[model samples]
Target chain A: MKQKNKKVNYSKWGYIFILPFFLTFFIFSFIPLVDTIRYSFFQYFRSGLKWIGPNFVGLENYKSLLQSDMLRYAGNTFILWIIGFVPQIVISLLLASWFVDARLKIKGQQFFKVVIYMPNLIMASAFAMLFFALFSLKGPINSILISWGVITETTPIDFMGTALGTRSLVGVMNFLMWFGNTTIMLMAAIMGISPDIFEASEIDGCNSFQRFFRITLPLIRPILAYTLITSIIGGLQMFDVPQILTNGAGSPNRTSYTLIMFLNDHLKSKNYGMAGALSVYLFVVSGILCYITYKITNDDDPDGSKAAARKRKKMERRMK
Target chain B: MESKGYNRFRVIFAHVLLIILSFLCLFFFYILIVNATRPHAEIQKGFSILPGGYLVTNFKNMISDGTYPIVSGVINSIIVAGCSAALCTYFSALTAYGLYAYDFKLKKVAFTFIMAILVMPTQVTAMGFLRLITKMNMDDTLFPLIIPSIASPAVFYFMYSYLQSSLPLSLVEAARIDGSREFRTFNQIVLPIMKPAMAVQAIFTFVGSWNNYFVPALVLETKSKMTVPVIIALLRGADYMNRDMGKMYMMIATAILPIIVVYLFLSKYIIAGVALGGVKG
Candidate 1:
């Protein structure tokens, strides 16, 4: 009885330890998300100083959002994401590989790393303002174009006034901010590969390309998967940059309008149900993306996963 | 060791590529610094190639002007960010300690529950969170900002793994044998072991909170209570304020300096082992 009591005390500490996280998460995150799910079914209306009810309105919010250009805004987000993410993946992958190359003799590698990640630490709103200024009419970019004879001073390109220009600016910002993070994560993954493996590959007369494809790529698949999924998630939720850039109007033909912007618009109009529905859609889409990432990345460990499963089963059997 | 001529060229080419990449990383920073020092008129005249002498004026104007309240914004940001970081690190580490050290009935359930929500973008929960905060009278207050960070699943996972990889049960046992209470064991023995992780995650949380705009934009309503990002947005959004381009640049430059300074001092520790447990969800 005393031993059991001691064990009970042991488990009590576990609960005590995790209580704060669960409590805070429940109050702030879980309840809110559950409430969002519930709110998706009801319409919100304000009543003077007191905000009124989430009266049940069934699937109307989802139907209305589907009937509108909300999907178009999603498309805009996808376009921005693609343009931004592709270069981000490619460039960061190259940098990651380069940084790890002992033969490269890259000087001040630490400085490059520190500088690259500096952007990530700064606020996105600050980036938006900085880019807005840089790309504004008669901004430095215009001056550079003029000097380079890319366009005459009289014909300085209006970057913010055009969809492609603004999208590209957004894309550039995403690339700049994220490329470093991806590089760091990927570099860590590459370095995690045992040096003996590299020595073994070299002993087999494997060329650099062979080493990358046969060893590095296979080894870093997990981090690659992680970065890809997170990048997609961040891209899908691209809000502050475009919103601030176009002053939240999604100007230049609403090209900057994203799902978050659309959702915010609904929220502004007190269309709480619609905002909830949009958030649910985002939630579902993210879940699906995560599933796909798991599928692809898990497949990379074809043998190891199965072997681990077997080991786990064996351990379970032994315990039983 | 002597290398072939072609291999030597490859090395040189790699250096050149690195230099180019580094330039790409540093380009905007250079532009921002130059723009911040230049006069408003010079900035408006299509960018001065060189730095002007208006940085002090721009800063002075920002300080004197109460409309933007750049100074208060910085203080509010520091408070919110600092509190969030402290709360996030300490509570997350505690939570991680719980999950890591114990074998409880709900351990797997708790783990899965938190991990499932880890990837759920905060935006999905924003509407409901704002409503709750408003109902609780936390809107326009920093409480919502600082409190939610306690449930940081990313920090939790990082610390959990850090503890798992480094901590030994025997250490805890030894402490218990030494007559230390459970809390004291954690505070004295476990905490010291988790210090490196706490520091790393503390910085991450700080930077994340400092730069976070979405939730703060929604929750923080008042002018004095606003964070740096919120203020920057308002100032940039105001059309007339646009004329003080140098001040705007200076504001941004100033906002990023503290973080850059922290990073410069801690870069060696930060970049190493940050992703040692990289495969986390």
Candidate 2:
């Protein structure tokens, strides 16, 4: 009886303690989410200020997104994602491996680490401004190229003016914005590998490259997968860089336009219904991509006695 | 013996490569700093590696022009960031502690809710949130800016994981046996022990709040209430294309100074916090 009373008292306190978060989450997060779904189906106008009726536009918004020029925007986003995500992971892994290798006693390791990570702290707007100044046609980059006689004096290369050039510029922005964070995460993964494995590999006469490929990469494969999946989701949701760099116009004939920017444009145009549809589309696409990535990586642990037994056998063999 | 020589070469090559990458990073920083100091003509003349002497003049112009409020925006940013961080950290700790210490049927459900919410990007529900705020007449106030952040799903998840891994259940059991109420126990015991996680979360929350632009841009219409990112973006639009390069660079420099200063001082915590947040996410 006393224990039951204690349990009741504890449960009541738990409710009280968690009330603030639950209340705030419902008001701020969950309700809005429900409303977003509801608004996506209705036709909203600027003057109505009311959500009209229960107009069921079941698949119309999705159809429009599929047929609209927004598909081009999605393709551009994927291009940026490929350019950014692939190199980011590769370069970050290389850096991480180099930092951890026992053979290389690089100077100012900590300083370099801190410096690389500094950009991550700056607001995206500020980072965009810095890059804008650097990449402007009359900016230092072009001037330097001209002074060095690398290019003819007549034609100045416009970094943000061309389609491919603008895409690559956005790629550079993506690289700079995220590489530091990746390096840091990759570094943690590298550090987590037990020294025993490295020692054993050394005893077996594995060189740095060999060891990295055979041991380190496989060991950190999980972290790499995690980074890749997250970066993909983040890349798909790319907005701020293009938003600020292109001054929210998506620049150079919307070549730098992302799905989020497209959504924002719809919202600004007071087409909340279409905007909601676009957001839901993005959400679904991201979800599907995340699922595909997980499947490709095979990161999920399988259930059932057979799978568990197979895992135990493998562990025993590895232990030997 | 040949392999040893090759290994030495490889080490040299790696260092050289890393050095180049580091230089690239520093080069960008140099560009920002130099641009902050140089005259508009020099800035437009392409990249100037050297700092010019117009920094003071630029600063005076930027401040006096009212395009960027160095003083007011910083104060406003501090208030918003500080309040959000405190509330977020406190509530996250509370929820995490509640979930950690208690055994209830809702435990699994609550944890799943937090994780599910984590996957929903802010943009997905932003329209709904805006509408709700407009109806509540909280559209123009800082309440919209600071309130939603208080229940950050990411922070809650972080606190939950930290509580699970680092905190021992014995501590909670002992406090409960001593007849302490749950809230008091958490306040007196659990919180003091969770200082490292709290410190890390506080800095992360503060930085995120400070650097936030989109939500604030959509919500706060007034200039005075604008955070640093919004103010800086607006200043860029008004000053940069308008040929007020002096004010533009000045605003940019002043806007970035707080983050740079904070980062320079608390880089270790910030890096750790970022790593933790990344891993949790």
Candidate 3:
């Protein structure tokens, strides 16, 4: 009996420890997510001061969302994401490779990292406000451009007033905010490669360009894929920057309007059904995009488990 | 091997590129700081790279402005962000320690369950969350903002990895032999050992909750209840009368000041934390 008492199974402790996290997650996130899906099927909304039906509407909300400007908002999201991401990934890769290159012997790498990452710490809302103030007709950018004679005072560029200008600013802001983070992550990925591998590749007469493309890029593919998937999900949820920058209007013909902004518009109007459907659409679209990115990045790996399995199957077939 | 000349050229080229990028990173912030010190008329006149004398004046104007509750906004932001960060780090660590310290029948399922939702964006559940909060009468209050941080999947993932590398099962076994209760062992022994990871994650969680705009904007309709970001949005969205750029810049500067100060002190840990999270993520 003493021995049995001494041999306590500690597994229940694990459950007890993790209970609060699971309980909170289920209550706060998972249940709401499931409910969001349920709400999408109902015709719940408010008309003026009157609460309307949560009556079963089946797919009516989804049908209406599809017929509306949902696709355009999605396109805006994708375009904004692509523009920001291209520059971000490119610059990050360049900076990451350089910083990680021991031969470069870069000084003050920490300072550079800290400085670059500072923008990311600022609130997106505040960042948007800063950009708005700076790009206003009377703001600093125009003032400088005027002083430089790039544009006359009378014709100062209306940056937030045009679709291209607004999109470009949003893109630029996103790039600035994220590139540092991407750089840091990529640097860590690069550093995880053994020095012996690089030495061996050097012995094989691989140039820097060749080494990066043939070794570093392929080795870091998993992290890259992870980065891309997260970025896509984050992009799909893009809101505060564009929302605040455009004054919640998505103005200039609503070309800069994002899916979340559209959802926000519906929510503001107390249209729960439409908002729920839009949320579902966002979830589905991000899921598909993440799946595609994962497949594309993983399937082509020469040394991956899937490839190995394929090779093993071929070998078995030959033996048979 | 690459020639000495080629290596020198590459080094110089890399330095030049890094310098230019670093300059670009700091330029806007520099502009923001410089503009924050000047009065509205001065800011509207033109951009200045130099500091001005009206910093105190602008700050006073922003804090004392009757239309916007900037002071309450700051306090509300602190309350929400502070509570969220503490709960997020503590609960995430507890969850990670559970998976780390013990074996259970559903251990693998539990680990995978948390990880599978790692990429789930909060936006996807906004409507539902809003509905939940409203139904619970949680809107216009900070409860919803602070309470849901208990299950941050990303933080839990980081903590789990940190524990795997830093902690040994022998420590727990030794504690059990010494008659330390499981919960007490975690609190007294494990928590202290996890101080570094907790600090790093706490800073990140704090900043994240501080900058969170969407959920708060959706939930908090009352001016006094709004966080700093929400208040900044309101200030920006206000009519032309309140669109004082200097005061706005001051407010924005004040909003970002805490994060900037924290970053200045703990940037080394924060960068390392990102790198750590990134590798396993």
Candidate 4:
């Protein structure tokens, strides 16, 4: 009885240990999240020194946002993410396969890995600034291009002036910043696969492309899915790079504008109602994306899925 | 014989591609560094592959300029990131240990809750967080930025998995038999065992906090309280365009130098940690 009592005492220590985390999380994160939702349904803003209404409204904030450029900004985000992610995934897969190919005996593997990943260490804001300096009207890139006669000194390319140019610059920067990390992750995933499987595939006369598509690609699907989901969430919250690059103006006609930048503008204007509504929108969208990815990627058990399908069919028959 | 030749050709092709890609990766950084050393007039003239002699001059110019509080920004960034790394690692470990060490009534519930919130992006809660900070009068302070480190779900997840693999419950039982207190056992025994995990997570958390711009930009109104990223943003403002280009580049260089230095020393661990984190997830 005493021994059991001591064990129970230890259980209370579990609560004690976790108490600080929960307390802080509840006060700082949980309450704020709830309050955000509360504010979303209200009319709240500050006009100069005077306080505006905290008056309750329906989904009026969300309704107005739909009428705004929110959908266009969302489209811009999707386009930017796609442009960056396509090249990123392709290059990462190529690099990972090459690095992991034991037969290749790639020299200085460690050196290559270290060099590639250095960009991920640097601050994104600093990175944006570097790009901004490099791609300015008389920036190094333009001057160099002119000197090399790639383009005449008469017409320097305005890299940040057009919609396509800005989006492409943004995409290229995202690709550079992330490809290294993605390559490293993919290499790890490929390495986790058993060597015997590769040996068997080679013995069966599988070419490099065949082996990758049939064996490596399918095996690493989970990691790929994980990467995609995280990248989607990250892309949705993309503000720092474009924000710094365009100096918060979203440039050339607001073509480079993003959803978070819009939300930030609302917050900057002290329009809490709109900002709160946007936050709730982002929350719901990300939650749905997370659920979809989780469901899609978690189909690791064929028999379990088959059983589920059978159960659904049985229910359908009974209903009939 | 044909296939053997084909394989050799493939190997050579792959090496060539890799070399080019690696060069592309480092080329912009090379340009940034080289330009940082050049005079503003020389920079305006054109790009140069060679390093210039004005590195110290650029540094001096950046310091003498009174536009932004560069010194205070660096100091504030260090304090916030350092405190965040420490609090995040210690509290995450403690939280993970609690879940791992005991089987209580709400154990599964708590575990699931943390995991569910793991994917909850901070951006989604920014509006509410801002409102909360204002109402609590914690605006313009480092407390909002640092205090939220206590409840980092991703770090908690990583630590929990690390404990599962590295720590044994039998050791806890043995320590208990020796009459060591619960907290002491955790601090003395578990923490040391978790040193590698903590170190890796510390680097990541520190870099994340340092690179963070959004939260700091919102919360910190005082120039003295602003972080490196925020200051760098201010330096990139339209008014600074007519300013000295060399100094601007130098400031940008300074902003990223600490992280670059840290990465150079700990590249192996940071790279390994990233792979490990992804795999575990």
List residue ranges in candidate 1 displaced over 4 A.
A1-8, A46-53, A290-320, B1-3, B240-242, B277-281
**Chain B alone, TM-score, model 1:** 0.94
Q: Which segments of model 2 are wrong by more than 4 Å?
A: A1-8, A47-56, A287-320, B45-47, B67-70, B236-242, B277-281
Model 4, A258-313: lDDT tens digits are 89888888888989899999999999998887675555434556236788888999
DockQ of candidate model 1: 0.60
Model 3 spans > 4 angstroms off: A1-7, A288-302, A305-314, A317-320, B239-243
| Candidate 4: clashing residue pairs, number | 0
Weakest ten-residue segment in model 2 chain B by summed lDDT: B238-247
Instruction: Please give the lDDT score at residue B176 for candidate 1.
Output: 82
Please tell me which model should have the higher lDDT, number 2 or number 4: 4
| Local accuracy of candidate 4 as per-residue lDDT tens digits, B1-281 | 12778778878998898888888778888888998899988888888989999999998888776668787888899999999999999999999999999767788888877876777778878888888999999999999999999999889989999999999999998998899999999999999999999999999999999999998888888887889999999987754756688888888888888798889999999999988977754
Report the TM-score of candidate 2, chain A only: 0.86
Candidate 3 positional error at B228, Å: 0.2
True contacts kept of 3: 0.78
lDDT of 1 by residue, A239-308 (tens): 9899888899888999889888887777656667878998899889988876665455435454388779
Looking at model 1, how many pairs of residues clash? 0
**Candidate 1, residue B76: CA error in Å?**
0.4
TM-score of each: 0.93, 0.91, 0.95, 0.95
The per-model lDDT (C-alpha) reads: 0.83, 0.77, 0.88, 0.88
Residue-level lDDT of model 1, residues B184-235, one tens digit each, is 9899899999999998888888999999988888877789898999988897
Model 2 — TM-score against the truth? 0.91
